[model samples]
Target: MAQDDKAARGPSVAEGAALVDLLLQMADDDLVLGHRHSEWLGVAPDIEEDVAFSSIAQDEVGHAALYYELASQLGAGDADRLAFDRPVGERRSAAFVELENGDWARTAMRHFLYDAFEEVRLDACTRSGWQPLQRAATKVRREEFYHRLHSRTQLHHLAKAGGEAFARLEHALADLWPYVASLFDLGPHAAELRATGVLPADAAALRSAWEAVVVPELSELGFGVPACGGTDATSAAHRGAHHPALAELLTTMRAVLDVDAAAASW
Candidate 1:
């Protein structure tokens, strides 16, 4: 039987909690990044692309909501509070999401890198030794597949279109690649998750898998994969110290949410 199959039939309370933590990390990353992405809802360079981008943004937030619901079931509190109420420092998202959306190239670059990593990570979760996580991953993977495809489409177009778009995409990739790998950091829950057999793979292992999945695609797109030289604590960036662009993005995203603290519905 698969590890998840065995986990499904047993009393694995510890593994369940570890899974909850993992879920929170996954949900939080998507929520914050989606919020940043949605800031471009109507301002995309072209209307058709805007609409398509909006749907991807919506899918990410929707994915976050689903993961939050699962986390709440395991006692993580309501999704909104978990999302909006937390200060920036408490957020577990990597620095990539916290950076400003520069141009379409930068936005697309970030999306392509993130979506590629998310796919590999979510695939691991789907086959997780923790049963609830396996089920959650299965549902999330369905939506994420489209996210990856959308990003890949944008990547192809940007690479094929020369001049400004190509330059922007290349610049964005070089700037963001280091932080992209940091997405799998998993923070303090690393050892506990592995001990419980919930995560099964460590950050290093997952990073290797993510690189294998993304590098070839990027190379084909004429973008170079980030090298191993920049791997150090100097590369350890976090969302706590956000770019000035992040503030602007946050203001736009929370415009409605900031209206009334007690607003009951979104």
Candidate 2:
């Protein structure tokens, strides 16, 4: 069959599970981080940033909805339920996103790092053999350009300011670096996804692509760029495990829905 025809028909039963796994991973990452970003609404360092982070948070949640919708079509259940109702252990978001947003510097550092990784991941998804994912990724990538710009610009300004600003950012990077590899862990069906071209690149290739973009930029900013691969045992557990923070986050995130279970259906 032609490539387009294959994509239009969707993945075979054998590939369906892997495709759903990939979709949930993408969706959960955005959803969890978006919630974290939203926490800055009234409290960001400045009014301008408050608005910027709010807008960025909206975009990330919207992107998550897009991915969740795709997963729902593939029989993952309602998008809202998939996002809000999943148990902590069932969530596929990386540990990096699940961590509480520490401080302004930590938030900025996480934003820059996650956006850099997202750029790489989404770029690869744009070329995926799955046409639906390719199209959705293309849409998300357009909006992500501004996100990357905002994060990079923030990092540059903070780095150039020196003194405590630079020190804080450096500290944030060190604290966050170990969890970075978890973002590239692609879940259990990674090999199948790569073989079927559902994901155009495997985790290692994606990580390398991410490093090429970030490592030099970070070095130029005078930050010590750490080695790129290898997750700690906790982070290496992929989607099967999560930090304790995620459980707390979910309770708060689902607070309203928990009260009104019917809200999720709407």
Candidate 3:
């Protein structure tokens, strides 16, 4: 198909709503988690990982902006305002992204878990019949290749090291699993998304696929994940709820935008 032809296929109003719903969930996840990862700029285990993580943060934020631009085309809002000006309750990020970045182990574990889910989601999006998403997913999935490797390498080394390092990694896994599993929550437009082929599957199907990949990988790393990830109720809570940490992060993130005059360019 020609690129121009693909770009010309705009969604109907109802389909646009589904598209917007998916876009907001993805944009919020990337935007919020990008900020969380940015918190580790100077605090990762070493300068190498710090720089690597900073790049990952930048990639995530770029992905967020891409998605927000797609939303803006659908009449959501400008990317800058959509990302920075939204009320806390209006964002649809999975609850896990809202968690505070802890020590090295916790941060790496969160990255591994999140990157795993993100890889799967990008794969699904690549299969979306929607042209804009198809292009974005293809591009983002290429970048995620390095992210997946970087995160998995960190988790593997820590888990295999044994002693305090191994113990800390195991503890991080145990502590983060509940929140991390919520990444698959698809928010309120699952049916429309699936029906329109904007998403390849419903939340439960994607959650199962995520577990199929992540569970055995964790088991191989020698930590038994105690819970079965998120239930329907938990998924709803994860998609709908905001953690206290998000508010704090937003306050700092929106500072420049909030204080400046409306027409000021930065």
Candidate 4:
């Protein structure tokens, strides 16, 4: 597509809504995952890594807020309420976001996997037909650039560490690879968004793009790619399946917010 053509046409209202829903899921996944990651704040294995990881976690939360703001403008509800008040099952986020921060290796694996996928996904959005979404995508793509850098740095270092770090990276990848598929499970919007050109690509194409990026990275790290099926794959790592640590993380993350009985400002 030509830049002038894209600039001239932009996105229609309905198309923008479709784009916002996609953005919301992206944002929600990052937000929840970041909150889980923050549990490692003071406990990170090293100070420099802790700082780097913290920035990624913060970026996720910031990205979530931007998506939530868009959703709220579209009448989805206020950002905080949409983020905090929804029941877990109502959340459109993939199960990967809810995984426990098992160890630095596991956390780093999550970062690597999610960031790798998000980069492609956002790039697709950056070229969206809708102006608002396209603009938002441009901004988000910039932020994710850093997220990818931070994650890859950790992934490479840990994989090369050749001790507990290596073991941790291996185990984390083994655990996270299954749920990685869920990131592209675009669901009912797949057709509608594609037809409207709201999404520049379809789920199958997105999945392929993700694999193209992710597989090579994993290979370089000496890890094998994990198999993925739809939600019916029936494994401990299946989509929609939440980790045991998720409940605990939610409890702590929401505790302060829950205390105010719904009317309090965050």
> What lDDT tens digits, residue by residue, belong to model 3 across residues 63-178?
99999999998999898989988888888888788888777888888898889899888889998878889999999999999999998887888889989988888888877776
| Residues 179-238 of candidate 4: C-alpha lDDT, one tens digit per residue | 676677775566777786667798778778877887887888788767643332535333
Measured on C-alpha atoms, candidate 2 has an lDDT of 0.90
TM-scores for all predictions: 0.86, 0.95, 0.93, 0.86
Error of 3 at 219 (Å): 0.5
Task: Name the runs in model 2 displaced over 4 angstroms.
Answer: 230-237, 262-266
Q: Pairs clashing in candidate 2?
A: none
The local distance difference test score of each candidate is 0.76, 0.90, 0.84, 0.74
Clashes of each: 0, 0, 0, 1
Candidate with the greatest lDDT versus the true structure:
2
Clashes of 4: 1
Q: After superposition, how far is residue 35 of candidate 2 from its true place, in Å?
A: 0.3
Candidate 1 stretches with Cα past 4 Å from truth are 1-17, 229-231, 235-266
Error of 4 at 246 (Å): 4.2
Stretches of model 4 off by over 4 angstroms after superposition: 1-17, 227-248, 262-266
Instruction: Tell me the lDDT of candidate 1.
Output: 0.76
| Local lDDT at 86 for model 4 | 71
Model 2 residue 7 CA deviation in Å: 1.6
- Give the Cα-based TM-score of candidate 2 against the true structure: 0.95
